[model samples]
Target: MTDTQQQSPQARATARIIAPVRHGLTQAGALAVLAGLIWPAQAACIAWVISGWAAGDTALGRTALGAGLFALGGLLRAALDARAGALLFEAADRTIARERAALIEREIRAPGPESSAAVAALAVQKLPMLQPWITRYHVAMTRTRVLPLVFLVLAFSQSWAVGLVLLVAGPLIPLFMALVGMAAEQASRRQLDEIGGMNDMLMDRLSALLDLRLLGAADRAAQDFRDRAEALRDRTMAVLRIAFLSSTVLELFAALGVAMVAVFVGFSLLGEIGFGTWGGQMTLAQGLFLLLIAPEYFQPLRDLAAAWHDRAAGISVVAELDALDAADRVALIGTGAATAPLDGPLSVDLHGAAALPGRAVPLPSLQLRAGEALALTGPSGVGKTTTLAAVAGLVPLAEGRVMVCGQPLDADTADAWRARLAWLPQVPHFPDVTLADFLDPRGTGADPWAALDLVQARHIVDRLPDGLETRLGESGGGVSGGEARRLMLARAVASGGDLILADEPTADLDSETAAQIVAALTGLRDQGRTLLVATHDPALAKALDREIAL
Candidate 1:
């Protein structure tokens, strides 16, 4: 194993995550009831059969009566045990889900550069990996922690010496299982990483399929995908191998311990040892009960050890998510600057600041008035879009404050201020729904055709078989770039917000079509709506009532 894998903190974190709900008392109660009752139930039945046999009575009838009682006891035990298990399972599932959901929310709130990839990993990869682990954690809590403790207590009552040995030594079973668990945690973590890596590789390849085909590297991408898949398969096999080996080792130890106990009981019955002190020589019935219960006592141990794999795997997913979340945080939604309302037309002013990383472009702050259309013009590398983002409440201000209607915008209540704004990103994401749905916020029959007509997108819609009702598959499929941009603008218009921010709305359109989009935007200005459009189109910018040149 690699050194990094060896130093995994998964075990400690998993224990903390599960520690609170590991109800030993609950497990012990169920197990004690099951163990304490099963022995007498079996012994009583056996004794009845022996008596019927020796007395030459109907042994079958006596045996049937005993078996019927045993079955009832078993049924009662099963019900109690199942109820206990259900409690554990539900707690584990709920706790994990709650933690994961909170993590998701935190991630969304504290979005940063690393957030996109991290979120994708958590949503697409870690969630499924946790399923097996949660199941195992639930089972292990009952079997290893609760059942063994109960068994040791009962075994001591039966024979102090046997009980003492069990109470003192039986823990070695879980201790040994824990040793195996530590090893399995590493293996499971590795397996999960490999699986995530393979998934990422496949996604990367698929996203770049056109590039690979164009470059004549499709064969190479296929080979790389195969290698990744194979690596994952091999790691998975290794995890299975370790699980199998650990389970086998635990079973072997349990079998040996049970067998040794049986041998000692046998010798004591034959008077090979001083049994007078240890319950004065166990009866055949007592010895038989011990023999039968020995396996039951250790049964939970084996199950727990085997089930540890699932718990470890599940914990591994949580661990990965936790690690990613630790790197990025979500900005709290409601924690904007202050509470007072801005009184007049909004204006944003930012000073010298850097744009996105790797592009050290200096940005300057500019102001926009409420009554007119303000066009921001700049070169491609300039912060025109960044400036718009800052104004629209998307990007945080570096040095300056944004004022609306002559009052400074408050951070703590940005939501109230944001409600007055409408923003159409450079590339807006639309769900796989109808254009009509996008245009009609109420989802009722509002003629999307009017909005389409405004942006001159009606021509494009007419070409589509379904028109406004046409399903725009993932992210507006079957729609041209200009049509999609127009659709986004239409949605913004439908939102009916006071301040409209459009980023390069004309970016992929012909000059003639672009003019129509600008005209549509100009029409919003005529409606007393404050409009801000970031673009480099000289003619469009000159046509606007006011221009902010960065």
Candidate 2:
């Protein structure tokens, strides 16, 4: 087995992300094991007092000392247990928050492990499952490793028969747990995968709810949701069933071990049996100690069995994290962060660049000087937008290089090159923030009324309840398509970038709306701002300075 495979399930699965928390887990486990070991000393004290009383030497001082020592051990155990619990909870919380933030930040800057909805489900719902495993499983695992052996030695120190019974019973629980864990991990993984899929389905249906209403397919949507829900429920039940079965097995073995020890100790103390004890016969104190210590032997094993399912679930979540790290996606040309503009003049040039990285679908050379407008005219899949994206340094090229604003569009200069341009995508998205914040994302505190008036969109904003402070939904919920396009244009104008890159700016609009958008593009070009538009509209193409057919 590999080094990772040899580690515990949680470690093997989550080591990439959870490394920082492992030390905390170890510290907490040591404290828990220390607390657990005290129970034996406490039991010994109680046994000594009872034996003294049975000998008719019930002195108050002796009894008080024994009781005090037992109480002190109990208090010490409680304190250690409480401290371990606190540390474990803190460690788990810290790990969860850190992973969630890292997942979200990485997704924002790069392509994520899954869809947006699935990523959301994983970050918000699925990740917290690690807490139970971290808090319960690791401590139980520690106890199982230490307490079982210590209890066996202590049992053998008193009676051979009880020790043999514990030895036989203890190993059985771990073996059974190992068997159940294989199936439990599979079930937990399926349940988490289903959750992500269900979230994706819900997001898709909600996004297309209007279209579904128009087509009168709400019943089909509901049925699909019902089926997904049933699958999730079934997967969850499978995990639970495995957990219950393992728990039953653990309890059965534990009860039997304790019962057999009781029989051996009780019969020996009663002179009915004599072969199991070290001194040929069991005393009252030995009998009491054996009965008290028998149950403690199986407690750690029971704890481990109970937490075995949590380990499976936690491992599945960790597996998801590792999957996210390995998933392939579009490579950003630069760091995809805001930076100062590169030193270059206002222009764009593409010399037979490929549409995608590691793909040999090259395009024609396109060049534009300052204050020129060019249209990329092609069919739907003719790489028009891809060409534009390549020029914008949003996608990498296979062979030829793109020069933007006199700078090579590579990782070193892509962010700076992009800072000198504005992009208007086919569909505009707005965060749930005020229009002022959306338009002035850099928080420059500039007046946007001029840009808004320039694009003929001030009238639309003037009618809104909050005007510049209006908070728009992600899809610009209350805004018409043309109006949203106009708002994007205003942002571009306000951005003060010399080049404007628009993709299908005139698509899905009426003649008047399309004309206004076209006029706005023409106006930007006339004002000495460079323009590159990908469009099929003949009017939009004719209005531009020249057209490049892909």
Candidate 3:
């Protein structure tokens, strides 16, 4: 076994993906071995009946007993095989569910830049490939190791010549398989990446359909989609061709091995070959039994060869998931902090705080008293947002200390500090739910209408036929930009936090709406909230208690 920590992502993923199904695999392997053991008995019974018939023994009772034993052994083997298949499929379902859950959870916790569309695609599309790998391929792999040896031992006990033929052919099968499998692995990885790219392209085009139509580029976009689809189909055919060739090669060797064993057994029974059966001539019954067991020896190897494609696809999926899990972007602080409501306003102090060392923005140190309002104004792209993000602990700090509520900000205290704050981002994300649900998903909070009224955005709810019950699309679809801003402001007002952070709150609004937003900010200040606003609006800045230029 390889050291787990030192293993590559594909290796690590294989280990974890198998852990949930380990017990099931063990049980299945046991059943398979039991079935293999039963096969030799069945073969022996068939040979005994055939030999008795050839000798012209008219003993009906002995023949009947041999036939009955053959039937019983065959039935037992079939039952074991069926039960093992059931166990493996059930385990496979559970394993897929567990892995998907982990991938989604990891993506949810990932930093903003690290959580891309590829992550979602891998979780939904790529991860399911592991199902076949576990259920069929992995089961076949275990049987290939166990059953072939059992058959070989039985064959050797009956006739060593047959055993030697199997031993020679079996090693050749894997050697050829290995050569084919290397090419298959590379093709499988490429195919997976191409499919992922296709998914992303389709998603992007669908999301931008309206824009493309308006710009008269819809025809070009459709052509691109067709081209990508064709390429994916071509790649898929390549993978299939390799898989079929591998199966064909294994089948050829297996047939050759079986043929050689059969010819050797026939010659030995005729006394033409004299070197295979414990230094004595082989009897017809023993020769027939060895012939019957020869094919069984090579069956496991053939099954494994058939499942090689699944192994390639599964390892590729694992590598993709590992890449998603390995993202190292800076994440939010205070995610695990205890929640405690603030009694009053919060005081924030940033000492020599700067943007992350290599970033473009370098923020200056600043201090604010409890219940104070400060506006951050500068030319565009001058670290205005970066300053607010650093203060909010949304980004990593490289050269300064942030003291909040008289305590230095660290992971332990970050959550508690964030609980007392409400942030209004430049771009808001809204799920597909009722307007009421957008305001409070739990449906138990301060009246959403009252918050909208304070922001002068009550007209938005009134205009909708469903009022607060009106459903929005993703990213607040069906709402205008100004309306979206007001909705976010309404949310912050309803949050009842002691600190409010607003970014460009009135950027696209008319003078009337901008004044209403300013009034809302003034209202928050009067309510003992410490406010930080990053903006370029002179009117909004003049209304604040203090101004800081980056």
Q: Number of the top candidate by lDDT?
A: 2
Pairwise lDDT winner, candidates 1 and 2: 2
TM-score of 3: 0.66
Question: How should the candidates be ordered by TM-score, best one leading?
Answer: 2, 1, 3
The TM-score of predicted model 2 comes to 0.73
Model 1: runs farther than 4 Å from truth? 1-16, 19-61, 127-135, 138-142, 145-172, 191-231, 255-291, 314-343, 346-350, 354-388, 399-413, 425-488, 502-550
Task: Return the candidate ranking by lDDT, descending.
Answer: 2, 3, 1
Of 2 and 3, which scores higher on lDDT?
2
Tens digits of per-residue lDDT for model 1 on 244-360? 888777777777778777887788768796652354766655555556666767776776776778777777776776576556332533554333443455555445453342233
The whole-model lDDT of each prediction reads 0.67, 0.87, 0.80
Per-residue lDDT of 164 in model 1 = 57
Per-residue alpha-carbon lDDT of candidate 3 for residues 224-329, written as tens digits (9 for 90 to 100): 9999999999999999999988898889999999999989988888889999877789999998898888888888788778777788888888877666555555
Which one wins on TM-score? Answer: 2
| Candidate 2 residue runs with Cα over 4 Å from true position | 1-21, 48-68, 86-127, 199-218, 263-275, 280-285, 318-330, 343-345, 348-391, 398-403, 406-408, 422-440, 443-550
Worst 10 residues of 2 by lDDT: 353-362
